[model samples]
Target: MNEIVRIDNLSFRYMQGLDNALEKVNLGFEKGAVIGITGPAGAGKSTLLSCINGVIPHYMNGDLQGHVLVNNQEVANLTFGQLAPIVGTVFQDVDFQTVSITVEEEVAFGPENIAIDPAEIENRIIHALESTHITTLRRRAISTLSGGQKQRVAIAAVLSTLPDLLLLDEPTSELDPIGTQEVFEAIFELNKTLGMTVIIVSQKVENLIDCDRIIVLSDGKVAFDGQPRKVFMRSQRLAEVGIAIPEVTAFIIALHKKLGQPISTERLPLSIGEAQTTLENILRQYGVLS
Candidate 1:
């Protein structure tokens, strides 16, 4: 698999402070994989995402060390104008990213700023709107949309530039359940169909249950990096770092301990359907179901 992002001994510290915000972090993300970053509030999750887009040392005053490479180019050496095309960022607050009144113009803003041809910008606007399933709202004012709709517009805006890697900071934080599902579905489609590499920093682990991998951060360092199942099964460690597993996975663990069943934590289920299947199998073995 092609590497989309690579971090080597990356460390950063606020100029006004004495402690490091990120310390000696090392990781690699491949194309077409959905990776999740989770930790406590002060664990530097957002700072890590910002580094991918060159926001740390570029937009903010900070002391930085090590390297963050996107598409094999170091972020520290790239300008926002040069990085915009390859790495698109969706901030936690969608309202902060909006720049146009209508959805169509908002989606076209980035391409326009980059001097893309008018015809090509129009084509990209339509494609992004359709990709995000917000084509019907293209003509609507940005203020009139709900929180979820606003976030969809923000994503469409980024997609208009056709970025190879997407860095999302809690994209579904403010959406309702239905809206959250819509956003996740769109992300899933992009990863599976368009082969877009995604790295999301989120507090809600339930939304990341299907991610290809999960990375847990604590005290500005990587605590765990592995498959979702492995991370979820390490409930004690996750809790220690202020991270939570999917509720269904927690339920399965509780049930297994209470029933004294030979439940393998390695195959822990992340979704309700998988949990149901596991429960049924356990019941059958106990002669409660046949």
Candidate 2:
């Protein structure tokens, strides 16, 4: 598959820093894929997303090397306004995202800013709300919505611009369980159904279990980059880098050690239902259950 976003030998340092915030970080992302980025604090995760949005070398001066490409266009060469149509970045705080008083007005803001035709803007508003599963919240006051609803509103606002790529930094960090679930559901719909490419930066590993790929950064370098199961399989290495495996995966790993079963790492569970099935099979094998 062609890479929608590609980084090659990318290294950078803020003007005041001695070390690069990102070092030799070569990576690629596919269209319509949900890619998760996670790592310890100060691992340069946020810095990476900033590059794509033309924040580095523009507003923030830095020594840099190599390059980043979004939609095959060199990111550094593009101005922020130039990149706005191609990329949309949503931050963790919904408060910063909500400019309009109501959901419909907020969703319409992106397209309106670009001076989209009036009828077209209306259609985009409708599509964005429906895609995010927030059509019912369309006329509701932004202040009246829950945190999860507000987050979805932020996403819908970005979606109205019809950007080629979506960057979410800690989109669900401040959310409760239900809020988190709601955001992921919208993410899945955008990727799985609407074929939108999304990259999420978050430390919450459990929420990323369903992602197509996960990349772990450490000290400005890639420590792990693979599908969730394989990366989480090396729980010890992850822990060394101050990253944690999902709770269910950790449980299965511990169970294998305690039972001396020598289970395959790939057999470890990522979800609770998978854990249940795996546990039952182990019980049967041990004659502990019929």
Candidate 3:
């Protein structure tokens, strides 16, 4: 896989006297990957994203060590304006990010600032709105939209920039279940259809379960980096770090423990459909089902 982002021996502190927020972190993310970053509060999850998007040294005051490279260009070498072209970041608060009164202007903000051609900007806005399923809300006032609609509008605004890397920080933290699903679906479609490299920093483990890869941060260090099943296998360690395994995977793991029959790691299920199939297969093996 082509490497889209790389962090090498990364460490950072907010001020000279402060303790490191991130400590000796090393990671390489492949292009077009759907990556979930989860950890407890103050675990350096947001700090990591800041590093990726050039917010660490550029906009925020920080003492830094090591390098953050996006598309092989070191983040420190790029100005905030320079980094804006390659990375689009949607912060946790949708309300705070919205400045334009109407959805159309909001979505077009980034592209317009970058001086994209008028025709191209319109095309980008339309494509972004359609991609996020908010075309009908284009003329609506930003304040009139619901949580899900606002989140989608924020994503659409980021999408208008047409960035190669999309970083969202706890996008659904304030959303209801339906809104969460809506935001996630838009993100998944962007990954699947546009092949955009997406890194989402979320506390919601259930939402992270289906990601292509999950990175667990603990005390500013990577505690786990692997498939969802492998990550769940370290449930005890995750809990120690204040991270929870998804409920479905937890239940399946419990069953395997009680049966004294180890379940194949490859067959571990993260979703209901997969769990159902795995359970049915197990029943057949035990002659509980014909």
Whole-model lDDT, model 1: 0.88
Over 178-232, each residue of candidate 1 has an lDDT whose tens digit, in order, gives 8788778877888888898889888888888789999998989999999899888
Q: Which 10 residues in a row give candidate 3 its minimum summed lDDT?
A: 173-182
C-alpha lDDT score of every prediction, in listed order: 0.88, 0.87, 0.89
How does each model score on TM-score?
Answer: 0.94, 0.90, 0.94
TM-score, ranked from best to worst? 1, 3, 2
Give me candidate 2's TM-score against the actual structure.
Answer: 0.90
In terms of lDDT, the best-performing candidate is: 3
Q: What are the per-residue Cα lDDT tens digits for candidate 3 across 153-257?
A: 898999999888999999877678876887788888888998989999989888887689999998899999998888888888999999988787888989989
Off by over 4 Å in 2: 95-102, 130-149
lDDT of 3: 0.89
| lDDT measured at residue 47 in model 3 versus the true structure, 0 to 100 | 91
lDDT of 3 at 23: 97
The predicted structure with the larger lDDT, 1 or 3, is 3
Residue pairs whose backbone atoms clash in candidate 1? none
Q: What TM-score, to 2 decimals, does candidate 3 have?
A: 0.94
